[model samples]
Target chain A: MALRRTCLAAAVLLALPAVPAAALPPGDAQRGQAIYERCQACHSLARNRSGPRHCGLLGREAASVAGFSYSRALRESGIVWTAASLDRFLANPFKAVPGTRMGYAGVKDPQERADLIAFLAAAGPCPE
Target chain B: MRDTITSLPRRSFLTAGARSTLSAGAVLLLAGCGGNKAAMAAAPEDDINILNAALGAEQEAIAAYQLGAESGLLTKPVLDLAVQFQGHHKEHAEVLAKTVRDLGGAAVEPLARYDFPSGDLKSEADVLRFAAGLEKGAVSAYLGAVPLFAERELAKAAASILGDEAMHWAVLRGALGENPVPVAFVS
Candidate 1:
């Protein structure tokens, strides 16, 4: 019962509808640019490759892209891409959104994750 | 079922139960267990039905873990997580049951005694492998539902659980000398 309670507490904290403020330092988009190289292997701003393109990722509901074949978990996650969500997810992809198909293990460092999200938020839309 | 859930704080109960897993033992347990077919068997079109299906999957996982734990195949880390995983499933079931009931749907009652096949328990490694497979299936199950829920909240909740299942899969896979995360995409 004690174990059960602890686990429940953790999950509830994760599920709470309203997100708190960003915990890490404000992101450095320039630093994030350097960090995005790893992500660029599979993700790009304009076109989908092995992973879905990252163009205009901020404020988007996960897996809302028209043609990409996102995993059901991503489509159903119901998370809007806010800074807090992105930082948490980038730090640990599987933990933030379990069963996600995205291959990246996670960023691990808080600052790097913030920077990455900063870069993503600034990625803007693909050229028509 | 209603009584079991009402006693605890709902959010905590559900999340904790998510920690538990019914695992492969469910597949094994399904060989003989039974439920109130009429009340629990939900309609295909029902939004609650999807939850029921997920609940059923979690129940199966609980039985598997219970059987494995009692069989004494696991020691130290494995045993601890197996029990923890079972607790997670219990939370999942508890939360789903309440959600259905709150929405004017029947809660699916789990079988009284899921007959888990005994011979499958040979070694700790074997137990881990079985658990890993269960976690993997769980990931797939939740993944499939991501696009099916009419409400975005339901999808998010299911996705959250799927993430936990995926985490379990990775740990078990790594323990068994397999590549825990073999692919970029989880599917």
Candidate 2:
């Protein structure tokens, strides 16, 4: 009886559901990676991050890029960095936040959008 | 100076008229060639084709922007950013069209409608997710095409637009509180 109970408990513990890896919120990372290529012309993934770095971008202050001359709108938007907000801005810069220095059209595909966001989220400054 | 009235022969007058006509014809011909030269240079066969692709991409971008703006989930600042992008797309399209015309080529009409990505877009979060992916696609497409452009002017223009695209991506990522840099370009 004791052996049976121990075996049953172990089985139950093993059957617990595993947490899902950071699922993409909406955008597709593969496509987002490609779309992000255009950005590589002006930014770097490391260091001072000219124009802006893709690494650790989410949740950062809009005016945080040390050497970049950010537009007044982005600098003053007073919006906290978050995945949701980032999606809005990416979808349509003018629609999400007018007068922002960054000018680009929004993404069209929903899944790709989620994937991109998720990728960024996963790559974000590893939760401090 | 003796006042001798020497009436030039009719032949001289006729010859002068012929010379004037010939000069006028030459001027017109040269003008035509000049115009053609400019047109030809603007849209050499390769440039015309490349500009069309760029314009097409811009149109696609515009359509995407319209969809995102309609969602009403974005803030005012974001709205402005989108508008700027829309404007740039429009300008890009116009420039490309002009180049084509200068090159004696027909401008390709933009797509009447575009197919956006679908699925699970039930809320504001859904919309943002969609936007992110779309932006990535645009960026990637442009990057791939950049290497193929021959004119330095076109390349520079594309590069400038691309720089802004990166900024837009970073801003969006920043808003999401995600990492701005997706991949390091450095080896």
Give interface RMSD for all predictions. 14.3, 13.6
Residue-level lDDT of model 1, residues B155-181, one tens digit each, is 556787888888988998998999999
Docking quality (DockQ) of candidate 1:
0.02
Which one wins on lDDT? 1
Error of 2 at A10 (Å): 67
Model 1 residue A60 lDDT score: 85
Runs of candidate 2 exceeding 4 Å displacement:
A1-128, B1-43, B118-120
TM-score for all models, in order of appearance? 0.46, 0.44
RMSD vs true structure, all candidates: 16.5, 23.7
Best by TM-score: 1
Worst 10 residues of 1 chain B by lDDT: B23-32
Candidate 2, fnat value? Answer: 0.04
